[model samples]
Each structure stands twice: as C-alpha cells, then as structure tokens.
Target: MVLRSTRLRLHVGVSRVHRWLALIIGVQLLLWFASGLIMSVLPIDRVRGERLVERVSPATLDQARPRAPLDLVLREANKPAREVRYRLLLGREVAEVELADGAVVLQDAETGKRIPPLNAAMARAVAVQAYRGVAPTPSIRAILTASTEYRAILPAWRVDFPDRDATRIYVAQNSGRIVAVRNGTWRLYDFFWGLHIMDWKNHEDFNTPWLIGFAAGGLALAIAGSALLYFRWPRKRRRNK
Candidate 1:
C-alpha cells in the first residue's frame, strides 16, 4: 500500500511540475519557432543588406598621383606614427597616418601639410566613394550621434541614397572606414533577431539567464510530456487487451 501511495505521489508531482513548466515556457517556445522560421526563410546575404550593395574595385592610390615622400610626411607630423599609408581621398593624394597615441591624421601628400577634420563637403565626397547604388548621386543625410542603425560606430556620417531599398551607409569619420551598410531588409532581420535572441538592448547575446531558464524549462516539459505519453499508452493497451 505504501509503495503504491508513493508512486501515486511521484506521478502527481511530476505532472504538476510539467504543467507549470509548460505554462512558463510555452510563449518563448512559440517565439523561438516563429523567429527561426522567419530567419530561415530569408537569405543571409539579403538579411545583411549585401545583395543591395554593388561591389566596386577600390581605386589605387599610387597609380596616377605623385605621392609625397612617406618619410617627409611622418617627420612633418612630428608624431611617432604606428602606421602610415598614402591614399586618394576625394581625388586628392593624402597621407593617412595612425599615431601610437591612437590618433588618425590625414596630410596632403603633395604639400606634406596636415589636412583638417573632414568638412561636410569632404564627408560627402568620402561617402560618395563608398556608395555604389542605383540612385541619384548620394548625399550626406546627417552627422549621426550614438543612435540609429550604427550603434557600433558613433559620430559616424549617415549617407543617404535614393535607392529603392532606402539604403543608408554609415561612414566613420576618424577611421575613414565604411562602418555599416543598412537597408529595409536588414532592419527586418534585426527585428526578428531581437525576438530570437531575447536581447533587445544589444540585440546579440543569446545566453541570458532568462533565455537559459526558459529553454531548460521547455526541455523539461517536453521530456515530461513524453514520459506521460509512455505511462498512459501502456495503461490504455493493457485495458484494451
């Protein structure tokens, strides 16, 4: 009698726990399924806005311009530069130097003179070089703060192109690098990504405590459901027999 009573208690306890777990984790399970489906349906390149971007061969710096002597530019800067390279910025030969102190300086290669921080015109020119879109000539939309699509590179320029995708390119002023390419497709992917990872703030981390706990609860619920099926099926078979 005691053994039977203990078995009954164990079965009830497992059933209750399984039911509660299902209640807690069911919503997240549905989200996982829906998010996964959306992600799988979209091609990765389109999701990343790569398909909208036209690949262009970068113009060689040393091809036609008579670049200033590298040693002279470094000496003129009067800083211990960690790296130096001659590049054409806005059709003008310039020396891009990165100092050991983490400062990036641009010098006119012809005159070996320091160029000022990029003005609106210069930013527009730099942005134009990086953009290859089927639109009217792209223009500077805004000097971005630490907001919008480019959270990674703050104080970047937002270059707007009149393309069908409403393409916007983020160019970093200091690094002179094309920081991010964004469009409608990427925004949708990012939305689903936030739902999938459950990390809305950064939109990247997947191993948060809440996600882990819900996943564990969902897994336990599935196992318990299987166990319940196993136990109930045999009883039904025995009764039929």
Candidate 2:
C-alpha cells in the first residue's frame, strides 16, 4: 500500500509540472496566437495602404516561337499609345501608354484581356483577371498600385452618387480609352488588396526585423517544443514532493 501511494504521488507530481509549464509557455503561445489572429483580421486595404497600379497584362501575343514584331503587335493592338510603359518578359503580357490620355493599358497578347491562362503543369486556370481598364489584370495574381490616377472608396464614401469611372480605370494600351474603371466597389476592393500586400508600401522593408521577429520566434518555439516532446520532456526529473 505504501509503494502504491508513492507511485500515485509521482504521477500527480508529473501532472502538476505539466500544468505549470503549460500555463507559462501557453500564455506566450497565446500572445503569438492573438497577434496572428489580429493580423488575420487586419483589413486588406489597411495592409495594402496604397492604391498600387501597374501595367501587368499584355497587349497582343501568340505562342508562336517567333512572335509577331512590335509593329505587328501595335497594329493588332490597333491605335497606338504615347508610352508603351513596360513589357512583361514571361507569360504574354504588355502595357501601352496612350499618346492622348497619358493613360496606361494592359492587354493579353493572346486573349487581349488583363490575364492569361495559368501556366501550371497539369491544368489551366481561367481568366477572371480579364476585366475592363487603365487598371488591367485584376486577378489576385498580384497586388497593384497606380501613380497617374487615384483609387477612391465609393459606395462606402459616395453612397449617394456612385460613379464607377472616377474610381479606378484600366486603360487599353491601344485605344487609350478607360476600358475598365472601378470607382466604387472595385476601387475599394483593389485598395483593400493593395493594403493586404504589405500595406501597399512596396518598399524594401519586407524583411525588416520588426516584421520577421515574430515569425522567427514562433518558429523557434515550435522547434524547441518538438525537441522537448521527442527527447527531453519525457525524461524530465519529477518535481520535489
């Protein structure tokens, strides 16, 4: 009976230690958890912080090895822009700056829309990114912020008067017209996404210690806990009676 009582005390002692460790480390883990939860709830626009606008889609392209020349692309793109802002080297995409409006245009070389087929090995993703535009390629493919124009919060702001064109515009490189503009809800969404993309800062601070510290700590905690569980925890000395 005495031996059994001693064994019972040992078990109770281990259980008490386990609870104490859980309380201390569990609180720290909870902090990380709470921060992560808050981060998750942070609004996308708040995270994006900017109405990032860039010309990502292509104008006109073919999969043919020897793609049509610039002149041919321009001709197919029809009207010309004052500036052909930037060209995407991968996946057929082009941007044109309209000569008259000084607006940007994005077109798919193949589809002439803002987005192209996903180059995933097995399957092809559809083009929901293909929307009207000075702001083309509205896929979650990437976050965008613009310089020439502004993104307004409408429906949210201009509840009485909803003007789509005034919010966000996607210009066609060839035509220079506001092909697709999202002033109200569209603008709101893009702006939100921009925030979600590093609060739309688009700077070099992505890797700063301030940002990575929490993640690194969490990683360390996870690794340490795993090691303890595998090797050390089970063998820990029992608490003093």
Candidate 3:
C-alpha cells in the first residue's frame, strides 16, 4: 500500500511539471510550425527577388580601343595593389585597383585618370540598368552601414522602386556591382525565418539563449509526459478462480 501511494505521488508531481512545461513551451512550438509551413509554401526564387531583377553581364573589353598599358597605369597610381581588374563602367573602360589598405581606386583605362567614388546619380544609373521590372523613377539613398536587409557591402546604394513588390536593389559604390536585391516577398520570408530561428533581432543567429532554454524545456516536458503515461496506463487484472 505504501509503495502504491509513493507511485501515485510521483505521478502527480510529474503531471504538474509536464503541464507547466507545456504552458511555457507550447507557443514557441506553434510558432515554429507556422513559420516552417509559410516558408515552405513560398517559392525560393521569388524570395530571392530573382524574377524582379536580372544580373548585369560583364562588359566585354575591346582590344581595338586605344588604351593605356597596365604597367603605366600601375606606375602612375604608385599604390601597392593587392589585385587589379579591368572592366567597362558605363561604356568607359576603367581599372579597379585594390590597395593593401583595402581602399579601391578606379582609373580610366584609356587616360589612366583617377575616377572618383560613385555619387548618387551614378548609383541610380547602375540600379536602373540592372533592374528588369518596369517601375517609375526609383528613390536613391546610400546605406553606409550593415543592416539585416542589406549586409553584403558597405557604402552601397539602395534604389527603391515603386512597384507592387516594393523592390529594392543594392549596388556596391566602388565596384559598380549589384550586390543584393530585396522585395516585399523576401521581407515576409525573412520575418518568418527570424521567428523560426527564435532571433527577433538581426534574424541571423539561431543559437540564442532563448532557443536553448526552450529546447531544454521541451525535452523535459517530453520526458515528464512519458513518465505520467507509464504510470496512468491500465494493467490487465488476473482472473479470480
């Protein structure tokens, strides 16, 4: 009789813990399921803004065009170049020189004249050429710091298009390269991704303390519920002869 009482008390104690854990961890579990379902339903290409924008092909270098020798251009720059690349920027051939100090210098390939950093107008032009959607004149702004939406490069241009998707394109200021394309679809997907990962801010980190604590609680709940089930299940009684 004492053993049976001890078992009943143990069952009650485990049941209480299980209920508390369920109350605490149930909401997050639902959020995880909902976010996962939404993400799976959304097409990945639209989320990446692939249909809204097209990649700008690399400009072909014209050998027939009269251009200054690379050696002469490097000598005049007088900077220790970690790397150098030649590309056409808006029909003008230019040499992009990356210095040891991580600064990028653009020089005219024909005249070797130093090109200044891209201004707002130049950034807008780049964004326009890369964008495939038919939208009105886009609002241009400079993103000087890293953000959750645009994190690829610093000092980039954010060209906002007034379209259905609210498309935004990011262009690297120095390289004249389209870095990232973001739209309303991508934003929605990212929001759900943040919820799934339990990272409300930044939306990148998945190893937060909140996630860890909830995972531990969920495991405890499972164990306690299993114990309760084992104790409560009815056993077959022996027949009286």
Candidate 4:
C-alpha cells in the first residue's frame, strides 16, 4: 500500500519544471565548467599579431642610471590626472610612464624629452603620438583636441634606454630595448583590450550587473509562476486504464 501511495505521489509531482530544470542547470553548469576549463588550458604565448617578449636580465644597481623625479614627469604631462606613481630603477636607466589612459612613454634621462618616438617632418615630431589614434588624448591633441592630451596615469617606472626607435618603441624596462616599437601600424592593441573588458561569448555583455539584475527578474517571475501553478492551481486527472 505504501509503495502504491508513493507511486501515486511521484506520478502527480513529476513536473515540466523538473524536465527543463535539468536543461537549465546543465547550461549554467557548462558555462562555469567552460570558465574553469579555459583557465586550466595552457597559457598561450602568441596573441594574434603581438608576440610576448621574453624576459631579460635586469641590470645591477650600479649600471642602471638614476631616474627622473615624479615632479618633473607630472609637470611634463601638465594635466590633472586621476593618479600617478613612479619607481626609479637604477639598474635599467629607463623612465617608464604608464598613464591611466594607457600611454606608455619612455623618456631620455638627460634631456627628459620623449625617447623612441616617430620623427615627424619638422616641428611636431615630439607630438606624433597623436597620429597613432590609440591614445584617447594623444600628444597632438593640442592641435586636434585644441587642448593638452588628457592624462589619467603617469609612468610608474623609469629605466634607461640605450637607444631610440626612429618610428616605434615600446621597450622593456629592464633591458632598455624596444619591446614593441612601432614600425608603422598600431598592431591593433585596442581591440584586444576591448575583448578583455567585454566577455568573449557575447559582445553585449551579461557580466554587466544591470543585465544580471534583469536575469534575476526573469528568475523571480519563473519562481512565482511555478509556485502559483504548484499550490494555487488544482490538478484534475482523468482515469487511466
């Protein structure tokens, strides 16, 4: 009798929600599982156009030159920034400035002028950073934006540069050699960063809290609908053979 009763209950209680629940849970689980799998997968060195620079030896303290002061660089930027930090490495003698807007400039020690910059025709060579179209406020903003380049982050470290790249230079701090100097093209660095901030699957972005909240609303509606169906609605059954 108890077995018969239990069978009767299970027959009535088995639900469409449970049927679909497996599907929903499976999909969510797959996403989380994929995220885990993505991490466990080997870290790839080669990114589309850009190649990762191999780490080089840092110079000894005596060999590295003294770094220019934060005050001097801040003055050079000449803008109200969100933040600034600088580290002087005597070993490398390169001044590395990382701005919030993501401008990295390595300056010469003695002159404090920008090093590894593309030389323009006559007067505006120093300000050629604008033409790259990467900087939100490039050096040429004085001409283009009619204002100084907006700076958000100042360079964090200054190492020495042994030489400059005539057209391009994104050098490594330790070795003071170009890690990625511009030959001509941007190499499309911005698109990669955009991918990082935005999720890979959908460009629209469910990672955004607002979208999550919308999803939660749908979840609430589903729960409420299920509760109403379970308790408030009566089940009427026809006799089976």
**Ranking according to TM-score, highest score first:** 3, 1, 4, 2
Each model's lDDT: 0.75, 0.40, 0.88, 0.38
TM-score of 2: 0.28
Per-candidate RMSD, Å: 3.4, 14.4, 2.6, 12.3
Segments in model 2 whose C-alpha atoms lie over 4 Å from true places: 1-167, 172-205, 231-241
State model 2's lDDT. 0.40
| Residue 144 Cα positional deviation in candidate 4, in Å, after optimal superposition | 17
| RMSD, candidate 1, Å | 3.4
Backbone collision tally, model 3: 0
Q: On residues 1-241, what C-alpha lDDT tens digit does candidate 3 reach at each position?
A: 9999999899889999999999999999899889999999999999988897876656698888887788877876788878888887777789888888887788898888788788899888888887888999999999999988988878888999999999999988877778899999999999999998899989999899999999899889889989988998999999999
Measured by TM-score, how close is model 1 to the native structure?
A: 0.80
Model 4 gets an lDDT of 0.38
Model 4, span 139-201: residue lDDT tens? 211111211111112221111112221133232322233233232122223233224333443
Position 156, candidate 2: lDDT: 13
**Model 4 lowest lDDT segment of ten:** 141-150
Put the candidates in lDDT order, highest first.
3, 1, 2, 4
lDDT of 1 by residue, 77-133 (tens): 899999987776767778888999877888988888888766656666666666656
